[model samples]
Target: MKILHRQRHDQSSSMIFRKDYTLLIIYLSLSLVSGEFMTAGVVAVGSAISAGLLAGFNVINCMINECCTDRWVSTNYTDLKLTLDAKLYGQHLVIEPVVKHLKAHGKDNPSKALALSFHGWTGTGKNYVSRIVAEKMFAKGMKSKFVHLISATKEFPHKEMVPFYKDKLRDFIEARVKECPRSFFIFDEMDKMPPGIIDTLKPYLDFYENLGGVDYRKATFFFLSNTAGNDIAERTITTWTNNLDRETIKLKEMEEVIRLPALNNKSGLWHSELILKNLITAYVPFLPLERRHVKQCIKDGLVHKGYYKSEDEISDAKVQEIADELQYYPEGVLIFSTTGCKRIHEKIDLIMEEI
Candidate 1:
């Protein structure tokens, strides 16, 4: 039985070798007939073919799983702009800076790793924007191996584990950056993270070209927090009360309002070196969603779930019915959606079930 098994394995190996040899012959013949082998020389022709094959294999591998090849790392700035414009509602303040920063980062080698701090009320598109950015930057989106998403509450649940968590976090970041220089790290629930734990990221987020031989300058970091949600809401409400266009609210205005609160708040970034040293690239505030914006979200939800073919197919009455289901805030005015567009899909699912 052993002899017969060996004979079959040898036959299979011979078949594969013959197949590969035949393919090589056919490739060389095609190259010669096309005059490529004559002009480029035999060695150059062979190298070109080898590189093409390698690229093809890499493309296939990236489709099957996450990879660090150009296939996965390529960024689509146009698509990013279109997506944010369409899906993100009520945050005119978010669109320009996010796109411009990402475009600059994608186009040139940065002096330091790109770090963005997102602050806003829950469901105001903080997490949604993060996911969108990941999708636009990576072919596999958030599932890409280079994208590291760490939830503060889940990763560092206990204050006693801060020391151990710090070490583990440092080692993890170093390893990921070594594997892929363009690594993306996102920290969610930054408000719940224990103090001193996030300070460990100071080195990676700094202006240093390398830390211990690993180049972290090409990496990107995002810190999502609800620390300044109330402040952001109040500012937006004040703007609306003054009859000022929300779009006219500048980044500087929002930054001035939230910067102090963020530094003082008991979040991961609270008094952290990342804030004190000015390592954060931008403090993006996601403005609260108004009733009309919530209606847009409902229309989008209907279209996304296949309940409607297009936004036009959904009536204002239907959209308002779903929008009214969500709780609004600011007492008499009830100006902003308390939850923004968060869980809007679930709300749609519930309403559909009733039908």
Candidate 2:
């Protein structure tokens, strides 16, 4: 996995017999030794049976805890998305590289356990990517039971659940992730999953550390959160480098990060240019599109009110004006309400006055 990390660390289970178990052993032994001959015999018989039951329960509990702890190290992650790939952030970007890489080496990847955490702004397609991974697993005839929706934001009791998350959440997630052969669990808006989930998952975003006995290895665990930073590279390249250290590879990773800028960057100019090239110059497996059609996208969809009604109707001067106007008052683009848009319009009037 290009994004998440895995290390060869000792996956050990501590078999601690609780004090209660010791107390039970003592009580049963005393009961067996201190009664009248016949009474003692019967008591001894019952005590032996009780001891066996207690041991069984203790063993079962120990097994459960250990299994949960090591889950992160045991799960197999195949055909998963992990990289600073541009398609994720750009509109009409090619999906072939991710799919091609997986197809080429999904089996060859040596790591038995893999985890993927995908985060972006609202409606930025994290869920869509998870679904695509699930479908790919299905195509390969892998038994992948991908859990598409995890409303951890509302359900997880972030405070009281800290120990629970640290002790067992990863195992629980990975268990559900691979109920079949290849499973995935997508946690959307995962930041709100109590602070514990964030702290625990930060490693997946940043680096590979050998935290002993951390479950969450199974299937591919995807954390979808809204992240804000000027550099999209932080999400992809620096993710691994940041956790490791101030190494030179960190710079190389920067290259990866730049390739996968936040999805928002892809929707505007550069994305339009790519789509135009595919339709016009490159002619790479897609129907050719007129430049007017591309211009029309900006005119109708981008402009708030005074957009050119037709694509060809807009001139270079008009497009440049719109770009400049939007960039000058960037906050106006996110204002969804009439109140916000009206304020932006007032700002536009001020700028026009200057012009």
Candidate 3:
């Protein structure tokens, strides 16, 4: 009689376990079908809890172990010390988002996952911003790897400078995950990376966690692309995502897009007189300053003064002397010089004589 009773008890326990497992499967199926992400999450957590209790493991201990695992990733914290007060980057006050995101990622993953997509025309500071962001990440104790594709010909090199096709980026990520397990990765020339690269990185977008069948990614990624002052088309990017079928289904429009404006010529009109002066004052006699150089100086001076301030402290006579001494500055110092430079000296000389 005792043996029979024990056999019955064991049978009942097995039945209960089977029932619970069936219920978990049903819940997951329903959650997935209904597209209720939160509900699915709850079901998963509950199932995990029930399973842990059945396995004779301390539920609270397991949770603590996971938390500790996350914490043990990085003991070093980054210091946000971006003192560059520019229009784009506010003081450290606005750095909370970046800091919080990075901190959370550092705790959970081996690396930071950041995607900085710079869209603009040629010479629009897209690459510049990427470099600056990478530097700032480094400043904050993050070892960042930069893949600059600021050009169409050169894309981000995979390991060994080998061929890295965009469609194969996810495969590449999977391949290199072990090598760069804990480094901030950036993709320059983002505009050229095949949509596949973006697709492979979608899973790393939100936060570090296992999504669907894949384990959670532990890295930060940045995408730098030139779009000539407009955001990359959502349909186009989305189309790429669909084509690549990243584990994380990212809508094309959902891409974190940052549009950088082209360098505004706040130097006003580059008339012959101003152009000549710019050339003479900037480089002449001493050295002839190109239009590009003068533009930068003017912009810097404005930034320094917190407004438009020119470094033309030299007297008009000196400017003229510089212009006279350096033929390179003859046609410079113009307010707007888009026209021809043929006989620019004659034109500048005439203008100077008249003035």
Top candidate by lDDT = 1
Q: Write the per-residue lDDT of candidate 3 for residues 162-220, one digit (tens) a residue.
A: 23443444565554444344444545554443333344355545444454444435555
| Candidate 1 whole-model C-alpha lDDT, 0 to 1 | 0.82
| Each prediction's TM-score versus the true structure | 0.83, 0.37, 0.36
The model with the greater TM-score, 1 or 2, is 1
Ranking the candidates on TM-score from highest down gives 1, 2, 3
How does candidate 1 fare on TM-score?
A: 0.83
Candidate 3 TM-score versus the reference: 0.36
Over 1-355, each residue of candidate 2 has an lDDT whose tens digit, in order, gives 0111123234244234455666677776666666443485677686777779786865666354422222322222343444324223332222443344334424433233333334333433455565666554543221222333556645465566666655465555434433432344556664455543434443322222223433322334455544332343233234333554222333233333332432224211122322222211111011111122233333543343554354566577654453344321124432111121113344444444433
RMSD of each predicted structure? 9.0, 17.7, 23.3
Q: Is candidate 1 or candidate 3 better by lDDT?
A: 1
Q: What C-alpha lDDT values do all the predictions have?
A: 0.82, 0.39, 0.36
Summarize candidate 1's per-residue lDDT along 24-95 as a digit string, tens digits. Answer: 756765766575446657666666776676566556545655567677787558888899998898888898
Among the numbered candidates, top TM-score falls to: 1
